[model samples]
Target: MDDQNNFGAQSTLSMPAESIPVESIPIESIPVESMPFESMFIKSIPIDLTSTPATNWDNQSQLILSFESMPIESIPVDLTCAPTTISDEGVKLQFDPKVIEKKYIEERDKRLRDDGIDQYVRLDQERQSDLYAGSPSPRDPIKKEVDFLIMGGGWGGLLIAVRLIQMGITNIKIVEKAGDFGGVWYWNRYPGAACDTESYIYMPLLEEMGYIPVEKYAKSPELRKHARAIGTKFGLYDKALFQTELLALDWDEESKRWAGTTNRNDNIRAKFVATASGPLHNAKVPRIPGLETFKGHSFHTNRWDYAYTGGDTLGNLDKISDKRIGIIGTGATSVQAIPHLAAGAKHLYVFQRTPSSVDVRNNQPTDPKWVDSLTPGWQKRRMENFNTIVTGGHADEDLVGDNWTDIIRKLSVLGGKNQSTASADNAAARQLADFQKMDEIRARIDNTVLDPATAEKLKPWYNQFCKRPCFHDTYLPAFNNPNVTLVDTDGQGVEKITEEGIVAGGKTYELDCIIYATGFEFVVNHTNKSSLTIRGREGLELSEKWKSGASTLHGLHSRGFPNLFIVSLMQSGLTPNLTHMLDEQAIHIAYIASYCVENGIEAVEATAEAENKWVQTVVELARLQQEFTKQCTPGYYNNEGKVSDVVLRNSWYGLGSPAFIELLRKWRKEGKLDGLAYETAH
Candidate 1:
């Protein structure tokens, strides 16, 4: 258990900083009822966290920590423009520190389960109503074998396949649940779907694919096309089984390989397996009351019925021009797709619970002259440089001058850029710096949104990193359209879905169609993503072993699952640019697999000692982030304000993405494979 997270974890009562510049936070218009905290807080007092005795622990473990609920207005932060003082260090914001609740998670059959997604997945599958309506993979079942079996044909698996082939290991096969390669791109066909991360850094192996993105932010179709191009280039098409779902992956001691059973009758056997099944593959529709009773058309944004919508991903939704549309979410997907829906729907009702932090996305075409001027290794250098700067490291220059880099630049300045060295480690100073960034973000919303009421309603009250910050210039302006109506739920979600429309905040919004922009479940169980089980040595289910928490060394190898790698960002370097992270992991996996093949090793797995060391290191680094997350408003980043047991697990490498990649590169260069234990087939 985290010492800081325990109940009554305070020790000393003091001030934030002596003689610090005081800024009075204006709270004139903010509704008192909308805030989170209640009568639980005491008056002014700041605790010197370091003075707390280490042995004094909070042993209480429960789901919802009881709180003394109070009105936001009753909270003691001075609303008037009073100069904040050293005595005002007890300026605790909205959230009640005592009310850390456990999120919705269930442990089953010895593995962590995504309880939130079970109903959503079932409803989505039934809505399609076609057993075989997904991707047209193999109609017939057959048995096959290979040297390596990769799960999910998304960027991670494709990159691994490409790297393996490049290493002269053409015996690998990629088994994707979807009948395609793009992973999230293939699954999410919602209108206005595009990456928030810059295309140059987000798109991996650009030099290898010999392709350049057309614009700063690449859309879904282009990304999907890029996936296919990579598959073609690496000859993964012939070796891949599309629309195939694995039932279980078991070790076959006799054959010295893994026996993978699937939904199809075909059983696969491979020397190695990579569970790269990404989180975005599983489509989840919100389980609202009377959701199915609606007589009009409705579908998840992911499985977008383009035929009914009368447009492709780029959106010309002519058929829906006469229809009344209602979108249920206001997240990243909704921010992009709503504008397109507004263009088509005669009347569009955007039922929003909480407003997303929408930042500026100054998207533009890549300059052809600038592109031509780049040298051979410019792309790699640019990607590395961006990653370094974004993670608080000093970079020679800022290549991508978008919102991401801009925020980091500002943060760098606050972190003692005035003093030669960047001292971002100080928690007090970091929190102050974050305040500056959020202020700038709120100011941006004020500038873009025309209506003061709508702008204030849309301004996110939380920290910038609290939610996945959305970026789009068109989203806010769409509200200005005569047809678009912003139905703010005021924190409470839609009360219920009636047959005609949605009832929220005591208002009935009748509509012809309801579009579910609720996104997929991210940072979830592997079984949930793959919709399959993995049985390692001695019939031990993968879920059972990780029931306590994720166990991995550098997010790659697990102790029992020899020759098996968990590919996504779990227990590894987590960067916003996912493709870049995947490629680095792919390269490392390739080098290690090559080494095993050359050395005649039957299986290689992480030792208990190695896994423990890695976990400890990651947990230590995670401490810094835990405090930061507590200050932000509840979102998936902080498990919706409920830091459950699973929430405490270290999901990523504490070090930055670039540093983690360099560590792997260094390990491979050393050529010893130090942390792994090799077992030959009996």
Candidate 2:
């Protein structure tokens, strides 16, 4: 039987009629002259008959050949089994290239809205107060002065504060909008919420804390507990002003200090200020018509209403057993919470704007023996190893072997050997690998969902990395439940919400509760998204200066914003494991603060020339990423698929995370602080 005819069956390669009598002879032991051909290349592998093998072939008998080198264009491709081709990764593509490309384009175009990101409405202050009313009691305002004041209570702020305390700069204050230390973790308590990245590398400062996560993917509660533990270890609780939001920041040239104001009417003066407000801080809802008319209980996933749901994060929702629940936006958040909803609700409606690429999340409990065997700095080594592999670099062995590393390994095998070069053949090779991976993802959906039509709707038709990839063992199986109804918008979202229910595809879904898993504002400017006004030298507004684009030295310090440090992803290194990037930023900030304190420097800012040079570098490096983003479906990664100039300007450093971190380390080692200008104390 021909390989093409066996589409969904195990493929068998047909052998030649006459076989060589060399079964017992080692491949390397055969004389080059005895071979049939001198230079025969099969699947990019050259036969080396004359040389010794790299490894011992004591048990070797039969040689296995790979067909990886065959050009995809050379093979006939069709939807029928007669013309199907199998990739080296064992992924079979039955659809024609033009047909699949058109299908992808059509799917993406239907989801494109004229409003773009404007379709989402940010919650007003009144709604914010109602959601964040978890504090014990309100307190009177006061005035205070501190050596350092950090905004945000997430990993970024926690790591920076810990490093500063270690350096003996102990006079610190942490202002958190939430009632607790955990930033995103504090807000996201929806059912099935957990760190998608492997916890061994995702959780920061594990070695220092001497802690081990109970599971490979740590859940929200455990993550929140760990955040508070870090705060307690470093005495951040006493210095933190909970449930207070920063309003404005002004630099005082004469005093060489920062004057800060907050919602609680407190005045603060600090020698230096750092804003670690994370990217996904503010929650947003879609601006669907008649949203206010919905008479039922509604809440965003960020502020999960446990009282209404009658369940905790573990998802034993006793209250909603007879209730009809409707969830909007099938992104990462909804992918997690849907399984629980399907289990608890009498009827569940899933309104999807676009389907996320879901993969297997084989979570396992941490082994005690493995924990006991870790040496000092083992976590750091593991983090670096994972980072190297994901960034398309070679490693002796994969430390945290998971789905993430597996995908990158496939890409590295094809086109990641040298990512700096933008050769046409390399780009094509990488794209082929991406196609193979996405094909496997779609096949998993087909095999899991029993219904043919529903399975087809759940399959994502874009690149693997277009949107954030989701991994859950139960997301797909939840659709098999009879109570669950998938309202696929065919890319277009729900038309509107009515007093009775939600209107989508000319049908009404009467839901007792509506969960807005619409997610947070990700691809917006820092000042606008955070709602913090910053005035620098000569009364220069930070927002106005960055209106055109982001200009900074190493994405940290602006030219005029003296002593103001920003910990954000814009124009900086980006990694799938964000905590790794945060830790690197924290270390750099701590080093700078230490240097200034050791000397008599009161204010430091990036020089104009250096800032301009770095901006140019960022733009130059972002070419490849910009091209890739243009081809992706509408999502936060590409600013709803607009890919505007401003978006390109605010792109992350095109070079991978490892290179970006190395640049920072090199600058610190030089010890001159080459890009910054300092003002000494009088």
Candidate 3:
């Protein structure tokens, strides 16, 4: 991007010639699609004239000499040279980077913002489920008070609850909207749902449980079971409020405690409130036309219709074998589930807007011998090693030698400095390595798929990091089956949904079922991440206060929201593996909460000055990552190409979680938490 302050006198629409390097061309100077293409192309397609035979070239030279003696009309116009590798940078931005203008964003504020999210959903009721046999237990009829109250029962809730107990902050309770404890894993029970990352590192409390997974990537059921185990281990299940939904949350300054009202018409008060409604639980259905009018059975992948599908995650979907199925969206969820659907459905239609970058996933069962040969604290050590390498930091060994660590392993071999503290040159080297990796994955598609046209459409043109990379050994080969059809929409999504089928790319595919593979909506709108209005001391809603942007001293405690805590990835060192980040945040928040408890402190909040400085530092730190994410195809990671200034600034800790953890440990070591306001009894 050209420096906005350094624009020249030329019209803004003018673009430099193709000979100029793309990096040197400022984004504001021109849009990618409008720029004149290289003369190396013959008509609309590209070819290699240089590869012509030597005898043919001699004849062509003689013809050219003859043309010199003839009129200009006799000369031929050559439109192509030898085929050349196209650099990714040469690919123009699909549109001006600023596709969504400022005015439109302002107009869309209420619809897209955090505060307005609750308006779209049933704010007072929890998501309905028939899985649990029991109904909500009889309420206590009166408001109850506790030392700590945590919202959510999944990864964020359970993990933080464990940490709080570990720190001796007992007398806590957890309010969950779900019928059970596994947040995302509980809801997303699709046939192929499993952890993409290795189970050892992805699962928390592994050491505590002394449990080893049956496979490298644990299935969804195992993950949910683990969450239940952790909750029971920490005695959180007994203190949990199931089928409870928070309607409103507000601070009680007079009593110096926070009060919350639930959908069951019960009131709960706590000296401190911590929200950990992990962002991934809320499923999003695209507002395609006639979605509600579909006569056929349809369900979001998050809420899989197991009764109708006649299968669990193990995938003996015999019930749906005769049914023709159509699925919209081919992201991670779709990638994993498609193989199962293709096997069962009489005919399957995969409607893809943008093809996910699929790579090889050679998943294998865990070796019992490997588990038997273990050591103490081996899980943590393995996690650190994996974290170190993947975050552009070096590791001594690659324990989980899979696709996640593949690029970094190559980086370490080529240049030792490609780790987290990489120099600018090393960063560029990593990028080139990334491009090469994506190219290999693309090549794999060509070699694997029998049809050239299918292979070409499957080949992702953008950089690998733009979207979440998917890996599966069976996915590509499954497409070779006659029953599976790939409906590539070229970029424009499905035109719309009709009662009987989906209309995509000007074609309709009729089906007996339509499964939504669209994943969870990320926490882009600050107010609506969790559909509850949290009011602080000044009676300002969390969303309203964060209208400018979210600011937290440690991504734990926010200013003005005294005694309120939030557990999430924002303003914290955001690791690609979300569980690692949650663990780090749980530890950090627990430490602070414990500190307040041991000292007999009543309230804890960050000073405004500290918050401003932290937010500024966070914004600066996230600049590069923001650029990287923004370039990716529309996904939850980048707000589906509708990124706003606040979205980037509020979302993540830019550098890496390892650095953030170290910083936090050092801060605790100093024995004083500066820039935090502590309320003490005089």
TM-score result, candidate 3: 0.80
Rank by lDDT (best first) = 2, 1, 3
- Residue runs of model 2 more than 4 Å from their true location after superposition: 1-93, 130-136, 414-424
Task: Report lDDT per candidate.
Answer: 0.66, 0.74, 0.64
Q: Candidate 3 lDDT (Cα, whole model)?
A: 0.64
Please give the lDDT score for candidate 2.
0.74
**Global lDDT for candidate 1?**
0.66
Over 4 Å off in model 1, which ranges? 1-123, 128-139, 418-429
**In candidate 3, which residue ranges exceed 4 Å CA deviation?**
1-142, 411-429
lDDT of 1 by residue, 464-531 (tens): 55566677889998988889988887655677888888999888889898888766665466666656
Candidate number of the best lDDT:
2
**Model 2 CA lDDT for position 41:** 12
Candidate 3 structure quality by residue, lDDT tens digits, 367-420: 989998889999888877676656545455788787767754553332223122
Each model's TM-score, in the order given?
A: 0.81, 0.87, 0.80
What is the lDDT for 215 in model 1? Answer: 92
Across 1-682, the per-residue lDDT of candidate 2 in tens digits comes to 0000000000011111122221122334432211111011111121233343623222332222233344555432223453324445332445554555567778777777777788888865554553545653778886999999999998999999999998889999999888888888887888888888888988889988889999999988899999999999889999999888899999998898999999899899999899999888788888999998999988888778878888888898778988999999898888888999899889999999899989888999999999988899998899878777666555789999998788777654543343323233343444555666777799899999999999999999986776777889999999999999999988888899998889999899998889898877877777987768999998999999999878888889998899999888788777778888899998999899999999989999998888887787666544334545555678787788787777767877654566677778878887998889998888
**Which has the higher TM-score value, candidate number 1 or candidate number 3?**
1
Best candidate, TM-score: 2
Candidate 2: residue pairs that collide: none
